[model samples]
Target: MLKKELPLKHIKINYDPIIDTPLEIIAQYPDLYEQKIAENGIDTIIYDNDISDNVSFYNITYALNKDCMMFMNLPLEVARFSISNMTDYIIQLLEKSYYVQFLCDPYWVSNYVSYQKEHHEHPMLIYGFDTVNKYFLAQDYFDYKQKTKQLVSFKDIDASYYNSSFSQLPDEYQLLNACVLHCSKIVNTKAKEINCDLIKQSLINFLNCYSYTKVETEGIYYGIQFFDILINRYHNDSDYVSL
Candidate 1:
């Protein structure tokens, strides 16, 4: 079932970047990524740093989807699919030049943490699968020490999927779907360019329309007004911020 690996590599790193799994996948599409930034006037793609100054989280997925791709969910019976069927499904994706993103329990994929003793859902990108060698070529942006890609055994992945605990929310499944990315379809299509003036106006309109309760008990606020309050509290009160 093994075929070919997409000749893709990490083009850049948004230091201490936002840990959004979807954004991590979007990062691989460098040209489209640049277009998004250019259109939106995103000075920093990294999210953790400038929370107050930017709108990185605003309509990001919509923008990406509008650009050049779609993630179609895959169906598999976690309790009944034979290993051969599962592997064949993955190999077919590789053969068609598509990347598979699997949401699995992190416990089986890593040995560094005691996550194996517990269940936690995580998304991993699959770039290549080898039937003869018995491993899947995977890459993770969540690792702090290293950003390069690595290989994971197919057996461990299979075990994790079968053993995952479905969440209370029916929409929030444990083994979630094996979504395949049709990046090949977007090879010639360019992401729509951002109109900086429009973005500015949108931000202005959002701020004008923003409203929220300030009661500390309510625990929520929105817009620049809230940001001012937060900054003031951080400077004036020791208990206002927490590590």
Candidate 2:
């Protein structure tokens, strides 16, 4: 008798009801909710036998827009094991591909860096370099978190305030401003599918206000070059025809 080989099993994911309860509260604020989904997709894969049995995986799939990237959110008990396994798989995939930029919230980097410093055996830390400038620029938010004991709130929380303060920053801060512009551009384009001249104008207004800062001149030049490269690549690539 010939024994047939079984198909490879798909990994199961579970969500934490307690932790995820806050998501419902956050959803009340439509703008905030949309921003959260944009920054961290609603579809988060979990791994728990108990929850997995009750919930329909379809809901998870639906929460995460079909176009967005998927990420596995491991529980604390299995975080290390799951992260190691996932990291290995990611590295293998990256080896086969060209470029892979892990676009994640800065807090993830902080946690991973701190974990590596403590244990001294982090695989991701293999590309460690001085992040002093990045840290220096982010010190205020980090300090606020340390004191208030709250996760860094997204910029949308006080859009006007940030918009004003952002206008005052030096050109060196243009990179950060560009990230915000990019996000705004994505949101406007996705929501309306029309020319976003208004959004672009707003970005330019914000950029213009910081003319006194030396960082502004250099930052604008760099930002334009970076934007052009990104636009050209995305436009030329048949697979990535749209932003």
Candidate 3:
């Protein structure tokens, strides 16, 4: 009998789940996350005009080992064929103090609204497993729209894993099917300090309807100005803005 689970002190579910797991893992190390989060929190990208535009405070870059915790890519193909027993592979990774995130078909995941109804694909993180109970501790947003952890059967996860089709995703998302989240080893001797100056400047820029980055960039938008941008965008939808 073997049991393994990692500590996740908190979960921030404001963004997509791919980025959520990294933030949840890093939150366990508050000493590292608190100060850094205050410094490099917000990011905005708008490469594609119609889509791919995003504005977020908890960007993945800060959550990765560079800021608080760490994560490494695990190609789903490796887990698919390389391991004779997928459950054992997941348990071994957990035993080593690593959390695993898998992009799976939500239809096979019982808690999801799409469960057993649709084959929509999404990400789920496995933080612990109980061999005795035949379930893995996984995290996801229920229909309630909050971060919730549930005990999922090993068989269901296996089905979800096999049913997922990553090929339909964009090329940039290729091989990004799974992740191994771990903590940093280096000790921080320096005292934690909030970057009040940076935060103040960001607030100023946001209030002024200016880009926080201060440099001129195309398409990328952020801060209070985004509201105006959205208003103007919606206003163009009809002869006049509707509500």
lDDT of each: 0.41, 0.24, 0.46
Off by over 4 Å in 1: 10-19, 23-84, 111-115, 141-145, 167-186, 189-243
Q: Per-residue lDDT tens digits of candidate 3, residues 1-243?
A: 467776554221122222343333223234444544323333321121233222212233323322222233332332232344667777877775555665566677787887777554455667789998889988766563776789988888777655455554355433233222322111122422223344335434534542223335475344444434433443343121010
For model 2, what is the error of residue 88's alpha carbon versus the real structure, in angstroms, after optimal superposition?
Answer: 26
Question: All candidates' TM-scores?
Answer: 0.45, 0.21, 0.46
Is candidate 1 or 2 superior in TM-score?
1
lDDT of 2 at 131: 26
Give per-residue CA lDDT, model 2, range 6-36, as digits (tens): 1111212122222222123223334444445
Tell me which residue pairs clash in candidate 3.
Answer: none
Per-residue CA lDDT of candidate 1, range 123-162, in tens?
5667787788888777654353554477777777776655
lDDT of 2 at 12: 24
Most accurate candidate by TM-score? 3
Ranked candidates (lDDT, high to low) = 3, 1, 2
